[model samples]
Target: MIKENPLVVSVGECGLDYNRNFSTKKQQRYAFREQVKLACELQMPLFLHEREAHKDLLEILDDVTAENLTLPPIVVHCFTGTEEEALTYISRGYFIGFTGTICKRDRGAHLRDLLPKIPLERIMIETDAPFMNFKKGRKSSEPIDVVDVARKIGQVLAIPFEEVAGTTFKTTSSFFRLD
Candidate 1:
C-alpha cells in the first residue's frame, strides 16, 4: 500500500499513551510495535505520540535497535513533556514537534523554558489544529496558528520570529524530505 501511494510518507502518530485509558496497554503495545516495524520495513519516517509512557516507549525503541533494525527518522509530535524527556529524545537523534500548546499564556511557560534546550535543527512546529488551541479562551485552532507557535517560541528563546520560522521550516522539510 505504501509503495502504491506516493503520498504515504510516514508511519505514525503511534506510541504509548498511558495517561489516557482510550486503549489497553496490550493493544497499544501491539499496534506501536507493528507500526515501528512497518516504518523500518518501508524506510519511512515515524510520527510518534508519547504521553506518560516514555519509559515503555524508550524500552521498545531500544529493543528494536538492539535487534539491529534500521529505524527511520522519528518525530515526537505535540510534545509536552519534562526537560529530561526532551533530552532523551534528542540524545537518540529524534526530532521533536511543538504545537500551539507552547503558546498558552500560563500552561505554556514550562514548555517555553525548555525551548532553549532543543537545537533548532531538531525542532519542528505544528498546530495540532482544532485541539491544542492556546488562545486565552479559544477552544479550537487552525493550521495558520502554527505561526503563533513559532512566534511564541521566538519570544521564549530570545530569537527573531523570522529566524525561528526559517529554522523550523527547514528542519521539518529536511526531516520529511519535503524537497
Candidate 2:
C-alpha cells in the first residue's frame, strides 16, 4: 500500500519504543524488523521513533545490514536521548529529529550541550509533537512550535534564530528531497 501511494514519501514513525512497551519486546522487535525490511526493500526513507531502546534498535539495524541489505536513509524523530546517544547516531550518519522537547529547560537541559556536537547539515527540527508533552506548558503542540525549537537551538549554539531556522529548513528539505 505504501509503495503504491505517491503521497507517502517515507515509511515513517516506525521504530522501537521500549520506554512505553505497549507491545511486548518480542512483538516490537518483530514489527520493527518488518518495517526496517520494508523500507529497505522499497528503497524509501524511514522516519523512526525510538525511546529507551537504542541498543536493540542498533542491533536490529546491524543485523539487517549484516545480511547485505543496505539500510535506507533513516531519521530518528522526537529525539530525547542522551548526548552519547546523539553522538552515536550522528557517528553512524543517521539524522536526528528534535521536537519541542528541546525547548524545555529541565527536561532538555542535556540537549543544550549536544546541539553543538551535531553537524549543522544534519540537524532537523520537528515542531509537530509526536506523542509528547513537552515545552508548551498546557497549550497543545502545534506546527508553530517549531519556532521555539529553532530558537532554542540558536540560543544553545550561540547562532541567530534566523540562521537556525534557515539551516534546519534547508537540511530537512534536502534530507527528504523536498521541492
Candidate 3:
C-alpha cells in the first residue's frame, strides 16, 4: 500500500501501547517490530506511538540501531515522557512531534513547559487525526487541528503562530524528506 502511495511519507503511527494494553504485550511488540522493519525496508520515516512501554520501546530501538538496520528518520509522535526520556530520544537524532494534547492539564501542560527547551529544529507538530481533539467546543481531532498545536507551541516559545507553523512544517518535511 505504501509503495503505491508515493505521497505517504511515514510507514508508522505504530508502536507498543501498554497504557490500555489493548493488545497483549507480546502482540504489541510484534506489531511494533513489524512496522519498524517495514519502515527500514521502505526507507520511509516512522511516526512512532509509545505509551507506558518506554522500556520495551527503547530496548527495541537499541537493538535495531545496533543491528545497523539503516533506520529511516523517526519521530516520536505525541511524546508524553519525562524530560530525560525526551532528551534520550533526541540524543539518538529522532525528532519529537507535539500534538494538541500538549495543551491539556497536568502532564500535558508539563510538556508545554518543556516545549521551549526542545530545539525548534528537532520538533514537529501533528494532530493524530480523529483523536486528541483540542478545538474549542469540539469533540474530535482532525488533521487541520494541527494548527492548534502550532499555536500552542508558538505561545510557549513566545513566537508568532505562523512562524511555528512554518518552521514545524519545514522541519517535518525535511525529516521525512518529503517532496
Cα lDDT, all candidates: 0.88, 0.85, 0.84
Candidate 3 error regions (>4 Å): 1-4
Top TM-score: which candidate number? 1
RMSD of 3: 1.8
Across 105-139, the per-residue lDDT of candidate 3 in tens digits comes to 76487798777778998998888878887777988
CA displacement after TM-score superposition, residue 98 of candidate 3 (Å): 0.9
Q: Return whichever of 1 and 3 wins on TM-score.
A: 1
Write candidate 2's Cα lDDT for 82-155 as tens digits.
Answer: 99998999999999999887877687888877888999778889866544556545556777778888888988
Instruction: Work out the TM-score per prediction.
Output: 0.96, 0.93, 0.90
**Model 1 misplacement above 4 A:** none
Q: What is the lDDT of candidate 3?
A: 0.84
Give the clash total for candidate 2: 0
Write the candidate numbers in order of decreasing TM-score.
1, 2, 3
- lDDT of each residue in 1-179, candidate 1, tens digit only: 77568687778889999999489998998889888988888889999999999998988887787878989999999999999999999999999999988877677778888889999889999998888877766789899989999998888888899999998899888787778
